[model samples]
Target: MTDEFASLNHFNGARDTPMPQDRLRAIRHGAEALREQLLDDPPVHFARSFDLLRIPYPAWFAFTGVYSQQLLKPHMVHLLARMAVVQYDDFEGRLRTLLFTPADFEAGNETPYFKRLAEKTPKFLHKAIAPVYNTVPQALASCGISPAQVDYITYDHLHTQDLRRWLGTPGLLPNARLLVHRQELASVRGLLPVQAEWYCPHGLDGIAAERIVPFDGSIQLGRGLALVHTPGHTEGNHSLVYRTGDGLRVSSENGVSADSWAPLSSRHDGIRRYAKATGAEVILNGNTQEGSTDQYLSMVLERTLAGTSSSHGFSNVVPSAECSPHWLFPGAPTSHLWGETSFGTPLHA
Candidate 1:
């Protein structure tokens, strides 16, 4: 496994540190329990087309499908399948489709022989493909999750596969709402040539395009508080905010890598502004040395306040950086200093 993949499991041995024991225990317990369930039926299957199917939430909030097959017909299927494995190891197996009709698989075929060949291909190929079909089922058995639990299904970006999976898993998450970004819904509806009805629930909040700007905001969920981060690597990315008795802490998803938080913060103006404005004492990234949450958070807070001028001519105050793309990343530092300037500031005027 690459460093990125192993990073997820890096926090396995840092219990000596003074962190919130309850939250750590909850996450650890959840993962171990899920793993035990998977171990009961070892040696999972991997389908040729749909390499992996992932039902992340047991309550059926989301389902992901990856197409592993390298066939010519389903280009989108192939792309999403590769992404699932390389970018995120969230799914279990792929789906393999057998196209019998020429028109269904291809746009146009002039010759009668080719048309006949398409129809006969399934029969001749059935024997060879039968063994491949069982691979995914067997793999899932090893993974220990029953096929019955999979509520949503994906076929690359094609809606047909999602429909197929949903139909197969009837009565799954009858109450839970389906969530999808407006852009994603539009893209899927436009590309897929299916006649299935699309519905957006009242709970759907279309993501704002300006979310790329980093701002100090909080979203309170049933679990806890999640902080919205504007800059890290991806645009509109956010991180979870959790509080410990010691101080305020933020769990950044892609905020920084394991070695050091300095590099990640070096280029992030929005993070700097947030730290300065909120006076956050701790910042935690997905990849970090265990037990350093408090230390790192302090470092960020110190760095943000350093070299900043206050409106009252106090140099000890935190400096508020401009929330512009140019200063955020991939550019030189701003010529003007941020503080009580001639104009009023949004964070601390």
Candidate 2:
């Protein structure tokens, strides 16, 4: 594929333009609103027979989408550091844990991806949110769960992840296995320089190859949860769909903010006009590996899978990198929203 439409390399196009003056203010306002929502509401919740916990990771900043840092100002877009844990009942009615975007996957300087990024890049524009950075253990503890309690753990993709951190030398979560897409595992085995530094070549180093549980495509993990294939962000990118109390919800990095996923809410002047005219979608997530076509289709698939969402005309697919402070720079830090629900009320964590 040509880098023009499918690449994670830093963009440096001369085609630059300033967003409306009101855009920045709007972004700040959104950040504050989301942050407040998270503070007021707890991250965990019960939906039917399942428990969902929205885990906040360290905040980070990086140019998002195609034009974010490459073609336009490096400060137009941002992503929040959000992850989730799902507690569901198996066919036998036994409670099982399924972690999405596990803490060991991304964020923090201790990670191989960030270490290399710090050494190789100049814009090392990321910050560890000391308040929430590496707080997954605490979050898990609050719910009376631990790594040993976890049945399965998965990330949408393995971009910035180093499995060794979680699996350890002989293996840490002895009872748990890393659920990953076969295609993604293949990609990780052969890292390309053009890809983001978030993916560490030695990530799976210590773990025995058998420890990695690979799947071919979309799957129904259980009655209440599923891992749907949506390969646009990467060949192995997937979305998590769950049956909430009210309806269905999805989680993926395919789209960053709700605005990116909610076409109805993305009616701002510049963005609206551009989206309508060019037939090209822009700034959906921090990473743009495949193309708008695949990403857009993935978005559509999320809604289709949702079937009946508590939301009106939109699917509930929350992105982890959401606390973006700027619109031009997708990686800039700002605020956070644990998870938006039309799905159901969150359980306290």
Candidate 3:
């Protein structure tokens, strides 16, 4: 299935070419076909999610409902940044390793946007968030894997990421190549006003072009791992699709929880009602409404590709930034939180 969906790659590029409903119908068919093909003979050796840290986010942006009644309050929700590890074979049939969303939290804080956000945080609250933070190296060590073992590094999007430390001078993953969407790489260099807040000023500066693998549309790295262009969260945002023992899992920051994909089944306030009232299949993580319609359709594509969780009714769309139940936001608890998942054997003995 490597190049089977080549024509459907970068579908977001032509959003105006087709009606949204028409585009959505087409996306469903493509996603369903891809899901069936990939699951039959998954080549993934191991896959799992690692906890990084939690940060405060506006409830309105996390779950934009039809009614703005509860959205206007001074409400905030906690979102957990996570990393995913997947090992598989390359086209040459040699085993390789990939790290998705392995964000360097310490380096990320240097961004003026987040740095200011941190400065405004109350001292006690800052201390609370500090305990949950984990570095990329620390997360790797927890899994008994080394930085040198990583062959590729990628993310669902470049938001809040500073890749200089990972791919620039004296990088941590010496042998790893950064896989990024061509548009995302360009967007980082020249950010729009709305995009600047979530991006690092010098994130991609000085990294040798050869060290980055920029791609358009969707591409499968190997048998079980594929990156599908699910734009709308950002113009170049793509979702990580990989096969697991259970089924296929799609990871991205497009939504914060399973509830974001299955809003009708959500227990959060107004979300379920809003879905029913508006006939919405998925809710947007409305922080960046740059392309709300496309984002909605992208979520639909993610849902179709992920199928459904046998244990949970919602699709197995693992959000990169998941909403966890916390004392910080009691009213906005997620019905389903994919804390961690590990399959097959560890990459290193």
**Residue 222 shift from truth in candidate 3, angstroms:** 0.4
RMSD of 3: 2.7
Candidate that would win on TM-score: 3
Model 2, stretches more than 4 Å misplaced?
1-76, 105-134, 170-172, 279-283, 307-314, 326-349
Residue 236 local lDDT, model 3: 89
Write model 3 residue lDDT over 88-144, tens digit each, in one string. Answer: 876677778899998877778876666887898887887575446677888788878
Clashes of each: 19, 25, 1
Give me the runs in candidate 1 sitting further than 4 Å from their true place: 1-122, 129-131, 135-139, 147-156, 159-162, 167-181, 188-349
Candidate 3 runs further than 4 Å off:
1-16, 66-74
Per-residue lDDT over 1-349 for candidate 1, one digit per residue giving the tens place of the 0 to 100 score: 1111111231233333466454345434533442233223322122111222111111010101111111111221100111010011122323211110001112112223333434655667433321122223343344343444332221111221222112212422222222222333454334322112221121113323222111222222212112222222222223322222222223222221111123223233543444455444323331112224433432342223222223322122111111111211222222232221111111100
TM-scores of all models?
0.22, 0.68, 0.93
**Model 2 global lDDT (CA atoms, 0 to 1):** 0.52
**Worst lDDT 10-window in candidate 2:** 2-11
Q: How would you order the candidates by lDDT, starting with the best?
A: 3, 2, 1
TM-score: model 1 vs. ground truth: 0.22
Candidate 2 per-residue lDDT over residues 12-31, each given as its tens digit: 12012255224333333432
